[model samples]
Target: MSKNVDYMVAIPARYASTRLAGKPLADVGGAPMIVRVCQKALESSASEVVACVDHELVAQALEPLSRQDSRLTVCMTSQNPRSGTERIAEMLRIRNIDPQTIVVNVQGDEPLITRDHIDEVAALLASSGAQMSTLCNPISSIDDVFDPNCVKVVMDKDNFALYFSRTPIPYERDNFAQGQQAVTELKFKHYHHIGIYGYRAATILDYLQKEPAAIEVAESLEQLRLLHYGMKIAVATTERPPETGVDTAADLERVNRIFASQGK
Candidate 1:
C-alpha cells in the first residue's frame, strides 16, 4: 500500500438482492457478510470506511461493529439508487465529503476482498490523474472468453479502458472463424474486468448528472457511461485475483466453508 495516498472506502450494502434477499445481513462463518466486508475495509489504510446501507436491519447489523471501531460507520441511503455507484454518490453528498477526495467503491458482498487491491485502485487514480480507476486480470480459461458472465475489458497502450462487454472483445476473428474451440496460442490477451473502482467524489457526482449512454444500456455496464461522457478510466492488471463475492446461496455456502476452514 502507498503510504502517501489517502482515501475513503464506501461499500454499498443493499439488503434486497434478487438472488439472495437480505444479502448484506447473510452469515459468513459467524458474522454477517456485510460486517465481514466492512471489517476488511476497516483493516485497510483508508482514513475512513463507511457502509452505505438502504435498510435499517443492515444498519443495525453494522452498529455493533461500528461501536467497536471509530473509523467504521454506516450511512442510511435511499433504495432508489439503481447501482452501487449511485449509492456511493449519495453517500458522498450526505456526508459532505470533499469533492476532490478519493473514494474506493468496494462491493458489500466481497467479504474476502484484499486490502492491497483496494489500495492499488485508489493509488492508481491518484497517480494516473484519471477521473476513475479499476483493475482487471488476464482470462486464463477459454470458457471465460466465451462466458457472458465474465465481463471483458480492452485497454489502450497506456491502460485506459477502450470498452467493456459481456462478450469476448478484441475478437479473435481467425480462431472463431476456423471453429477452434481450444486456444492454441494467443494473438491478444483477454481480460476479465474486476468490479472494484476508485473515483473522485466529484467524478461520481458528475457521472450521476449525465444521461445513460446507449452502449452502457446495451452492455448493462455503468462504467461505459463515464466513457461516453469523455472521462478517462485508468485500468491496471492485478497479479493476485480477487476472492469470490457472495451473490447466490451456493456462493454464500462456499464462502462460509472457506471462513470455517480458516477458523474465523
Candidate 2:
C-alpha cells in the first residue's frame, strides 16, 4: 500500500458507556471485544491500527494483539474526550501521524466491523475529496426508520450528508400518518448511519478545534457539528447488511451469538 493517504485505523475504546460500562474489555466469545475490533482493523488495507484507550485495563487487554500484530499500537487519550472523534484527534496528535494520512475511526464496540467497509470509507474520502467520510446502509424496515436509537441520515444527490437525526427525517407525512409500520409506503430512501468514519489527519484536528455547533448540541450527534460548520462529509454504503453494535447487555448478547456462529 502507498504511504501517503494510507488508511490508519483508530479504534476508540471508551471504557465508560452509559448503558454498558467497561464495554471495551467485555468478552465476546473468548477475547475482549476491542481485540476483535482491532483484528477487524488489521484485516483492512490500513497501514496501522491504534486502539485509543483511556484506562490501563483496556490497553492491557489489547497488549496480546499488539504483540501478535506489529501493525497494532495503543495510544492513551484524555479520560474525558468529548466524543470518539476527539479521541481519534488526540491519537493523531500524540502519535504525530502524518497530516496527509487518512484516519479511519472504527468503534471498539463494533466487533462485526468488516475490512471492506473501512477501506470503502477511506476511498470515499480520497475520491470525493471531502473533509470526512462515513458509511450508511439503506433502511429496510419500518422499525429502524422510527427507532430513535437508529439514527437516520439524509444525503444530497452527490451522497454528501445534509443532516442526521434521532427522529424519522424527510418525514413521510402521508405515509407516516397511517402508523409506525407505514414507512414502506414512503417514496424516498432512508439510510441508517454507520458510526465508522474516515478523515484526513489534519481535517480531524480542525474538527476537534471548532466550537460545538448548535445543531450538534441539539441532535447530540458530533457529525452534525461537521455539517453545521459546512464540512463536506462523503457517504458510502455498507458492502452487506449492517450488524448490531454492542451498546447494552442485550446488544452484547446478540453480538456474541453472531460471533459464536461465525466461529470467531
Considering every candidate listed, which one attains the maximal lDDT? 1
Model 2: colliding residue pairs? none
Question: Can you give the lDDT of residue 224 in candidate 1?
Answer: 97
The CA lDDT of each predicted structure is: 0.91, 0.86
**Tens-digit lDDT string for candidate 1 (191-241):** 999999999999999899999999999999999998998899999998787
lDDT of 1 at 104: 94
Mind giving the per-residue lDDT tens digits that candidate 2 earns over 51-122? 999999998988888999999999999887867877888888898989988888898889898888888888
User: Clash number for every model?
Assistant: 0, 0
Off by over 4 Å in 1: 179-185
Predicted model with the maximum TM-score: 1
Q: Which residue pairs clash within candidate 1? A: none
lDDT of 2: 0.86
